[model samples]
Target: MSARPSPIFRNVSSKVGIIAAFTALNLATDYMLTGLPNVKFMDAFYFIATFEFGLSVGLPVVCFTRTAYAIVNPLGAAPGFLIVFLVVGDSMYVLSGYLSRTFRLVEKESSAGDRVLSIGLIGLFSALGFDLITNFGTGLSMVGGSGLQSHLWGALVFGLITMNFPLPLGIVHEASDFLFFSTLVPSSLALLSRSGLITTGPLGRVIGKRGDNQN
Candidate 1:
């Protein structure tokens, strides 16, 4: 007789443990980087989460994490800020993941020249989308309607430079994150593939652009 699957697997205990560990790592990294004044650790963690888990998983995680962080920190200001931050930032992260997946799929099927263009378009749109949503929410909360234009412009410029561009440091950070967690949570990765959260199709192949075309 074939052996039954382990009961432990039914609870998703291992997957939850891995996510929690990674969440802690993300928080630690944010704390360490918070001293930089310019670096936004939440944003970085948001990106990392989306890249690792995809939007379906990452966005809810981000929302809950941000809510928990706000409850702990309290910031000594309005409580509304916490809500705004969690909602806007989580939405932005989800949008980024969606755009990243879409553009990657497009690029995978395109010619070599289109790959570069696709990436550029994806980066530009992702950054712009993040900037618009984040700044709009921030301005609404902090400065009311009057501040929207200035805040939008400032955020657009900063996001374009810092997040959209293929900065060497950012690339290194993302690559490191991909490598580190992928190694540590190989089972999670396997589960994702099995669950179809990570697709195995023409889209997935094109997204990776491995040229194997076997999905």
Candidate 2:
């Protein structure tokens, strides 16, 4: 009889494959939402993964998916040069998760309402921060050929432009993000629990459910 594969190897293989599939899903979804600009489910997925799998696994999904989406240029080439800032900014979601775990901010007894707001706030800040940092990069890239002082001034000018007309969109994105995280995280935890993808014995300390938490 063939021996069962080593647990470590199986774990690593499954994680790699899952990340790859997530990357593809991100690419496809971004392509589909190409024109919507601020509407996206990406942050929802980020929150769910972080809540369920913890930082080591979840952060990679955030970075890998964003990197792959940027490379695919589903929207256009305009964001190509700004991908670095995006990777950095978007990783804030993962950082929030790390902070939550480190502080035990969402302990097992915490109410569903509390977790929802916590995750929603993380999503909100992440979206807003990503917009700022990415636009700052855009300004710098725009002035690549200019002198240092000129580049700084140019960056400020572009920043102003972004803050004026595009600022409201930031709030819109955050609203959508908050909604996504507040709802999806709990719903996903419910499903994951049911499928035995994670068990109370192992992941309980991190992600558990009373079902009503989502309601």
Candidate 3:
């Protein structure tokens, strides 16, 4: 006669497995796409994990993936300060995912265009926040000394304006995130739903499967 647990809390070991799987996937994708400069799918995976499984699964995945990638990057390990910023910046996707789930931003009943728009907006804003925070952190790490405040502000501005310069790395980063979020994330969810794996969370509406069957 005990009350049933929420679906999110029902599968502890499976959820842990999911966390490890996502972290590994993020790291693999980051390494595979290292040459692309800012074009990584980490954000999309972070958002998808969070949106589907909630903060518990998302936080560990984000933390482990970002930390591992920063310390063992193909381009060389990031500095301690930069690594901290990278983790913090990437955590924004967790917040974005939580908000998206809470608000049911990408409901199963929504039209394809609407779903795309919702996920795209989330991706766009989350990417912007990630870029700003990490770029500022990059700037701060690059500058130091007497006029720290002024120098920090100047560096932040410089980082933003010239982030891509002749190459447009910044644009590639944001655009790729939007593309991945809108298409891949939802498609992944749908695939899971079709495979009968997604039976909970906001995505429960997918393929008309409800989370209500649980006792």
**Candidate 1 vs candidate 3, TM-score winner:** 3
RMSD values for the candidates in order, in angstroms, are 11.1, 8.6, 5.4
Candidate 2 at 188: error in angstroms?
1.3
Q: Report the C-alpha displacement of residue 87, candidate 3, in angstroms.
A: 0.7
Top model number, TM-score? 3
Better of 2 and 3 by TM-score: 3
Among residues 3 or more apart in sequence or in different chains, the pairs in candidate 1 whose N, CA or C atoms overlap within 3 Å are: 108-206
How close is every model to the real structure, measured as TM-score?
Answer: 0.48, 0.75, 0.84
- What is the TM-score of candidate 1? 0.48
**lDDT string, candidate 2, 94-192, tens digits:** 776665555555553368788778777777887777777776787887655457888877886785477437456766777888888778766876787
Candidate 2 residues lying further than 4 Å off, grouped into runs, are 1-10, 108-110, 143-157, 160-167, 200-215
Worst 10 residues of 2 by lDDT: 1-10
Off by over 4 Å in 1: 1-11, 41-45, 74-78, 106-128, 142-215
| Decreasing lDDT order of the candidates | 3, 2, 1
Give the CA lDDT, 0 to 100, for residue 120 in model 3: 82
Model 3 clash tally? 0
Question: Deviation in angstroms for 213 in model 1?
Answer: 30
Q: Kindly list the per-residue Cα lDDT of model 1 for residues 1-215, writing each as its tens digit.
A: 22211111112443455457556765666567644432344444454455444564466666666566555552333276546754675566456545554444433544744644443344444444555555444444444324667766665555445543554434443443344332333344345456532334432311122232331
| lDDT by residue for model 3 (64-176), tens | 99888888888898998888888888999999988777766567435889888789878988888888888888877666647867888877986797667777877888898
